[model samples]
Target: MTEGFLSSEEYDEQAHRLYDVGDYDGALEMLKEGLALYPNAVELCVGLGYARLAREEFAWARRAFERAMVLDPAHEDAMVGMGEALLRLGHRIEALRLFHRVEQMGFDDDIELMLTMGRALYRDGLYTQARDVFGRAVAARPDSAEAVASLGYALHRLGDDVGSGRQVRRALRIDPDLHEARIYLGHLLYDRGDWEGSLREFERVPPVEHWDALAVWRILELKRALWHMESGDARLAPWEDRLRALEELDDPIDRLLAEIESEVAEKDGLALDPSQLELFSGRAEGGREHRVRSPDGHVYRGSWSAIVRQMRDAAGFGHEPLSAFMRRMAERWHEQSGVDVPFRDPEVFLRAAVEYRLMFLEDGPD
Candidate 1:
């Protein structure tokens, strides 16, 4: 009876667009306005729950899911959303119980439900399980670029670098604008020691979307590394300061990152040439050895692989997990070479190591 009548489906569709683009507030406003016109719409309740989850309002999210379930007792999305909200609320046991119950009830056919569960697992640091769930989601909906990217990230988390890279590339091939795939691909190249390639991907990433909350922080780190190693002081200072202000990372060698950033700031027009920036470049193959002199006048001499081994042995990561290994290596890089590793842990750093060796240890070139 107003300017225009929007059906419940129309309202829900409009809300979906807002939610998909990281505009939770806009989505909520649209959903509420539509719900006022169609108070009995169960789908609108479900959409409200999802938008709340994206905003990290777990309590409200749980209540919204509960409302959706009340409206349609056997709604699969409602059940999955409830479980997800519980997981976010730190009720892992209750969430798992609900998940198992839903599976037993055979109501898990919705691909979105599976995607939501997979992301919850990923956030909980259960990467192996996340990979499995994402695999299922991809199998159910092969065209979902986000599912493919999530699976790739899970594989990366499990230290299957080749598999991770392949999955991420597959996602990119499907949807070139999928930011998660590009971010993963970027770090994958970085792992193999392709700084230029890594820089390219990281720079191309758009603003962090709601689906991936950590993208901005990851980009900041990557850019900071690139600017510090390739550009001079003026360029690096802003990125370095921005990263420092976040206080999100707990790297033991933060002082070293700060020091490197400062070094770039102190330099004039230019500071390093390619030969001097060997650490960032992956040209250490072909019987080429380089002597890297640290900022403190300490010198390490070796081929890239030799240096990696020396650093690995020094960090004592032979028996430890990849994340621990990378963290140790990052600390060593800060301590010895005075550079940020661009990864908060070894798993991410290992991706960068794929193209080239990342090390500061000095042994004779292999």
Candidate 2:
């Protein structure tokens, strides 16, 4: 029996050697044969789970990991494998729970586990929690630009724009080649209306041609959007030649548009109801009215911003168009109603009035 066990151990060692050499099929074959002789072999089960996971067979990988866990619940690799499989299956919450268990079981020191947990939380929209997890990971390995960038993303999601910017900058300082941090910092600056700053950030992004087509397209689209937004010129002439040069490449313009639309929808508290949208009016036989629905199920007819802009325009409101609107309003309101508009800054009052008027229009004389 001892000799048989030694033979099984030798077979397992050979299987691991095959796995190390990237001979996944041979490794799996050997592991299966070894496991057939020693069904409860924890190492064999873990190796099989890894092989299955590498092949993208997440369900089978999960089963093997589960069997390994049953044999040895303290197996860190098995636990991590199970978490990975669960993550791939979109069971993020379960994966997180398993990861947390791994952490509690003295796996908290593992940078990889922390990263996995942080990423899972980020994907689950728990940005604050993700940031905390990433912070721990960064503390463990301060030199990891990936961890710093991920933490920055989580902070950005949580609306800590300044904090996020700092984190991103720190990541770039650590590793100037960190393209994700550069891109994200650019996005954050763009969100805050710092067009020149955003352009500068984007300029630092590495030109990794053909490696990440979608990311490249996103960068291009962002530049175009920034140019158009800041200049208010829809002609796209400034970027036309460059864009044409990129047309032959994989253009992720549609994806970028979708992301922008979703972001706008979330910010405006409006439902991205496709049923309310009209496209290509110039080519259509007749002009069609697009209906938009809000998150509250209120049907809004027309483009969201256009409708709001028209309402504000009709109300004789001009925030972005006039530099003195806030100052003028504050003076007017102070003289008329004796109510201090509660804004110390001219821009703040201007934006507030625009928002107030928009709300008044929606609510109607209330």
Candidate 3:
């Protein structure tokens, strides 16, 4: 060892502090330096992989975890991280192999491992499985607001709204500032027509990103609600500039739209739905068994969950054009009856969407 050099223990303390403060790049740098001295350190390797994962450099993350696995083949953390990397890279079968290998090792009893497993399942869009995993996480860590919130989000995604809503409210009661819970609760209230409660929860969200999703969508939806209730129109004036600020800060909606368009462009002239969606069960052209036939010969190819997600995608990206007709509708609604309109109402919005060509939304089947 170099004279007067800091020990690996000292380096790890510094790296841990950097990681805790949301400096994944700095953490990676620290880990690389630490590993230069302790080449075989499994902790440093796993930490390096996670830091890379935070930055979304999935290949680097996989390599780092792979190195850790080479150092200690049976390290649960290394195996889990490797699975997560492969999952994110769209190697689902390979990822599942690693995940199941860990499961077979009987590591499910570990609360921390369950949490990690739950997150991997959630990322893979296996909502039911994720819900079960997170439920186990909640059982193992009753006091953890995060675990409760995870189960709540998974349940909501799985369409168990009643159970999901109860868990989310419980999570909020336990910790008011939990933004993921706040976001999920806001969506639930919006869906149930509790505009006031929905707005309150959305307003409570700090104007930033958390849990891998930005808060911009909530703000856009809030603006949509205000637009629908013109008696609530006073709120809209301020939101215009607020929306502009967020638009300037990050154009996540446009980016998301571009991703969708790029997905189609990549399918070699076939106008397939975005990869995230699988709305169409079976197609005559594909010759897959007809699980359920589309009403028309042509069909959309995306998941039901993706369609629900497109609601937010529409509310976020389609707000400008939809606003023109939406405002007119709201005004007429108020003139005829004094009651203000609710924007997120599925029926009301669906009617308007039939006419609006908002990203896979239209009056006619595509």
Candidate 4:
């Protein structure tokens, strides 16, 4: 009975069962033998292609699936398999054409095909098109946070920053554990110079019990960098003990401090005045304006006025006369417009303000 000749149907059924059970090697062997007896069997070719795909032999899989498509052009599985193989081979346009063919054949239920097309569009930087495809995916499955996040990322790439922010926030509202959305939001805030807001957003991420430690370390490093920039201090002694407490961090804050120190050294070496180091020491009180030639041969005026204002405010000057002046200006602006201007950290605000005043003196306000 074991040696009995099996019919084509029996062989095909056995091949499919073997494939279903993840025995790709066994399935390939059986299909190879079966194909010899039925050389033109399209199903057998598809089975062989699937076995090749399971084994990650994408080129071989493409050849087998193309043969299956040639034998039976209307074979949906063969078309999808060929498209996937082409996509893996980086023939994105050809793969999208095949996917479009699949769609034209009334296979709208193919969520995997849609996702593949969307990803291809994303890689090509056709983000608006990608967003449309991802929108369809969301419509098909409203509860999919992955789809929502993908759409949000597409929108962000397309320069719809506000829309992207809203989409990511919506994803977070739907699923608070969506780490990607949280990180993207943090990045948007940081780019806008909302350092405190960005820090608050980043801190919402829980400890990395199962998440990637590198991501957490990067966020913490960014926070420390912002703090150093605002405080104009590099000693790190005050935060040294707290940094040690974060033993689980893969790359410690001390490493980040060392990198910052190296960067300061490189930049400081190019400075014209050594005494100007006092500006970064948090001791300077007045803004300094300078005309410097940019590396691109562009002559531009740069000012460090904001740094002076920050130093003045931080030097135990509680409600000083300058503070009142700034308050009056802020209040006057608020009275003219309903929107309140965002106040930077004392040091940063002062530095930027002083720099602006110097620029006004040299270039005049535009």
Strongest candidate by TM-score = 3
TM-scores, each model vs. reference:
0.53, 0.50, 0.61, 0.45
lDDT of each: 0.64, 0.62, 0.64, 0.60
Per-residue lDDT of model 4, residues 70-109, tens digit only: 9999888788778767866668788778877877887654
- On residues 1-366, what C-alpha lDDT tens digit does candidate 1 reach at each position? 224889999989999999989799999989888889888799999999999887767899898888888889888778888888897677887887776676567645567677778777766556787888888778878888888888988898788889988889898888988865786676578558787787677667644231221223344456667555444556555544543332233333333444554686688887676544533333324445554433333343344333333234322222222334455556656787666674443223543443234423234444
**Native-referenced Cα lDDT, model 2:** 0.62
Error of 1 at 97 (Å): 3.6
TM-score of 1: 0.53
**Residue-level error in angstroms, candidate 4, position 232:** 20
Indicate which candidate wins on lDDT. Answer: 1
Using TM-score as the measure, what is the rank order of every candidate, best first? 3, 1, 2, 4
Clashing residue pairs, backbone N/CA/C < 3 A, model 4: 305-354, 305-355, 306-350, 306-351, 306-352, 306-354, 306-355, 307-351, 310-347, 310-350
| Residue-wise C-alpha lDDT for candidate 2, range 207-247, written one tens digit per residue | 54212222233345566676544433554343433333433
Give stretches of model 1 more than 4 Å off: 1-7, 33-39, 100-109, 196-366
Assess candidate 3 and give its lDDT.
Answer: 0.64
